[model samples]
Target: MVKKYRNFKEVGDAVVIYSDNYINDIEGEKLEDLCASYMERGFTSIVIDFSETDLVNSIGVSILIGIIEKVRDCKARIAFSGLKRVNYDIFSIVGLTKHIEIFDTEEDAVNGRVPQEMVTS
Candidate 1:
């Protein structure tokens, strides 16, 4: 099933991408395209708010890896907020947490309030 997502919004220096209930194969490509567009537009900081999302499949994880590659190439920063425990574990197991920061709230991500130890170069 296709997952729903909101339009990307600018929040200070970061752009926020809000995903819906689930992220699977169908939603992966769309997310990849959206993130590519943002990168093309010179957006260096991004926050993906998963407050409404609880599940993600392998395809979704792959898409996120693509975004992380782009972010690293641009020497940019990307963070995730409001991730459920399971989703958080998935990200960690995939080693995404090493490349991107995770926050308890969208506000913390947008405000660059993440702990120094959690911040990646």
Candidate 2:
């Protein structure tokens, strides 16, 4: 299915990327741009809302991985929120859950406790 790409919002230190469509390589580029722009603007922490997105392809996963690496370079972090069981499984299988944090809600993502690695770094 060709889903229409939706826009994203920047809230405080979080950039919420919400869309029902799947995010592939092309869309991943857009996400990368947003992350870079936010970092350039001095925002470090980010919460990517996947509540509306049901699926993410390999390319999308690569972009997310890239986000993790980029955030590490900036000594920052990215939180994934509202992921379904299957999506969560994907993250776990890829060992991304250890690298990036996940939360049940946006509030939890922003206000919830962070991992020690994230805090110490």
Candidate 3:
């Protein structure tokens, strides 16, 4: 399926981006552009809610990496929430977990509550 770029919502200082069921090469650029816009707007925190995203290809991972770079450039914090087990593994394998905090739910991510199980040394 052709994925489209969904709109994001603002939660205080954070901007939350909701994802579709799948993230592929097509959605990557859109995500990047959306994040860039948010950064331009002076948003310091970003949360990517993947509650509906069940699959993420290599291109999608690369896209996320690009987003991470943009967030880092602005010295902003970014978090990921609602990731499935498989998707979590993908993020772990790609070293995203080292930079972005992962949460089991959007509320937890937004509230900055990292699940005890997800906390790493």
Candidate 4:
């Protein structure tokens, strides 16, 4: 069984996961597990919200890459939101932006990628 992360909310076919202040090895693993569990649960969209995240180390970046690949292989859409300027630049430099969407807010991320059929007026 996968260990679920508590700081997340479900919207239609999307799930918004809030990141901790720092995304190091442990936190990154937890985030990966959470995202994987959500994918298994059949969510079509997954957004990782970095509103509170202050930093992401190299280990975290490596794990994020794995998570991104898993999400893609599962045919799911993934997005990142609320990233700080530095984090944004880091992600861009690392080519993560090439694989996923980036949004300014959790709502924007969720609304932008959730399966259209799952949306309501």
Which candidate comes out best when scored by lDDT? 4
Which 10-residue window in model 2 sums to the lowest lDDT?
Answer: 1-10
Model 1, residue 37: C-alpha shift (Å): 0.9
Q: Give lDDT tens digits, candidate 1, residues 41-109.
A: 887777888888889888899888887777767766788899999999999899887767788987788
Candidate 4 C-alpha lDDT tens digits along 1-121: 2224479888878888998999999999999999999899999888899999999888889998898888878878888999999898889889887657788998899888454432321
Stretches off by above 4 angstroms in model 3 are 1-6, 113-121
* lDDT tens digits, residue span 1-121, model 3: 2223446778777788887778998877777888889889898878888988899989999999889877876877778999998899898898888767888887788789544433332
How does each model score on lDDT? Answer: 0.78, 0.76, 0.80, 0.85
Write down the TM-score of every candidate.
0.82, 0.84, 0.83, 0.86
Per model, state how many residue pairs clash. 0, 0, 0, 0
lDDT of 2 by residue, 13-77 (tens): 65666544677887778878888887887877777878877788888898889987887788776
The total of clashing pairs for model 3 equals 0
Cα deviation of 17, candidate 2, in Å: 2.9
**List of clashing residue pairs for candidate 2:** none
